[model samples]
Target: MAEVHGCNIPEDRYYWIEKHVWAKPEGDVVLVGLTDVAQSLAGKIIVVNLKSAGKTLARGKSGGTLESGKWVGSIPTPVAGEVIEVNGAVKANPGLVNEDPYGEGWLLKVKPSNWDEDAKALVTGETGVASYREKLEQDGIHCQK
Candidate 1:
């Protein structure tokens, strides 16, 4: 993991850095979640609303929405696919997103319909870390907690 400005960026997952989202490819499905930077910036999350399973989402579409003390925004899908499952734990306890954004707070599972094409646009490994670092620095943004 790369820690930039107090944000955790796991190298194992593909990142749509601009959206502050991560995608972890697991066989045919991808596990999606908000990045630590996002959760940190959002402050204490109070609510999470996710699209139900079987819902098809295009790349960059809003898969769900999150509300926090300081922010409220849609969670964009990094890969176009059918939502295979929603994280019940996150819905039940929005604080999980702030406490463990990359782990138990994962938003959903998606079986990508356009993996090859969509993946080409995501960044991962060392390159992803560097890219995220640059974006953070450029925007003067830092993670809190």
Candidate 2:
């Protein structure tokens, strides 16, 4: 993991930095979640709405929406895929997104319909960290807590 302005960017996961989302491929499904920077920017998440399992999403489509004291925005899918599952824990306690944005706060599991094509739009490893760092610096964004 690389920390940029207090925001964590895990090297192992692919990131859609512009969308503030991360995707970690696990076998046939990919785990999706908001990045730490996103949670920090949103400020104390209050609600999480995710698309139901079996729903198909195009790349860049909103898988759902999130509401917080400071922000309200859609959670975009980084890859075109069918939603396999949603994290019940996040729905029940939206604060978990602020508490653990990359872990227990994960929003969904999706079986990608076009990984190779979609992956071209994402960044990972050192490239991702560098890109995210640049964006954070450019936007003057930093994670709190």
Candidate 3:
């Protein structure tokens, strides 16, 4: 795991630093979730509204919305794809995002329309960790416990 301003940015995932989102590929589908930085910035998540399965989302578009004490905003997807799955657990208990943003709190799974083209734009591995650190500094984001 990589720590950026005290927020965890796991090296295993691909990240879109500006969007505060992460993607973990599993075969044809990619699991998507908000980063710890995002969860921290939002405060305790109160709700997560994901686009329904089978819906096609264009790259850089809103895949859903997340609400918290501090704010409510769209969760933009990094790549265009079909929503293959949406975590129902998040709908019933949004706090799951606060508890485990990368695991059980994952937002959705998408079958990317153009995986090779789109994923090339994401940051991953050691480079991604470095990017996360830079993003935190650029945004003046300090993780709040």
Candidate 4:
């Protein structure tokens, strides 16, 4: 894990910095989740509504909706894909996102339409971590660690 402004960002996942989402390849599908920074910014998540399995989403489109404290926003997918599975646990206990944004708090599983093409839009590894740190600083955003 990499720490940027006190938020834990696992290098194993690819990030859509502007969207505040992460994607991890898992065989034919990819797991999607909120970043720790996103969870922290949203405060305590209270509700999550995910798109059903089989729903096709365009890159940068809303894949789900999350409500936390006074904040309610969409969780966008970094790539175009079909939702393979929705994380039921999040719907039942949105607080899990705040507790563990990258683990049990994952949003859904998606079978990408063009992973190779879309993945180019994301940043990963050390460069990604550094980019996120810079973006957070520019936005004056601080992780609530």
Those runs of model 1 whose alpha carbons end farther than 4 Å from true positions after fitting are none
Superposition TM-score, candidate 4 onto the true structure: 0.97
* TM-scores for candidates 1 onward, in order: 0.98, 0.97, 0.97, 0.97
What tens-digit string does per-residue lDDT give for candidate 2 at 46-118? 9999999999999999999999987888999998899999999999999999999888999999999988888
Question: Model 1: how large is the Cα RMSD against the reference?
Answer: 0.6
**Residue 72 local lDDT, model 1:** 85
Candidate 3 wrongly placed segments (more than 4 Å): none
Which 10-residue window in model 1 sums to the lowest lDDT? 68-77
Best by the lDDT measure: 1
lDDT-based ranking: 1, 2, 4, 3
- Model 3 TM-score is 0.97
Worst lDDT window (10 residues) for model 3? Answer: 1-10
Quantify all predictions' global Cα lDDT against the true fold.
Answer: 0.95, 0.93, 0.91, 0.92
Compose the digit string of candidate 4's lDDT tens values, residues 1-145.
Answer: 9997788988888999998999989899989999999999999899999999999999999998999887998999987899999999989999999999999999999999999998899989998899899999999988896
Q: Which residue pairs does candidate 4 place in steric collision? A: none
Report RMSD for candidate 2. 0.8
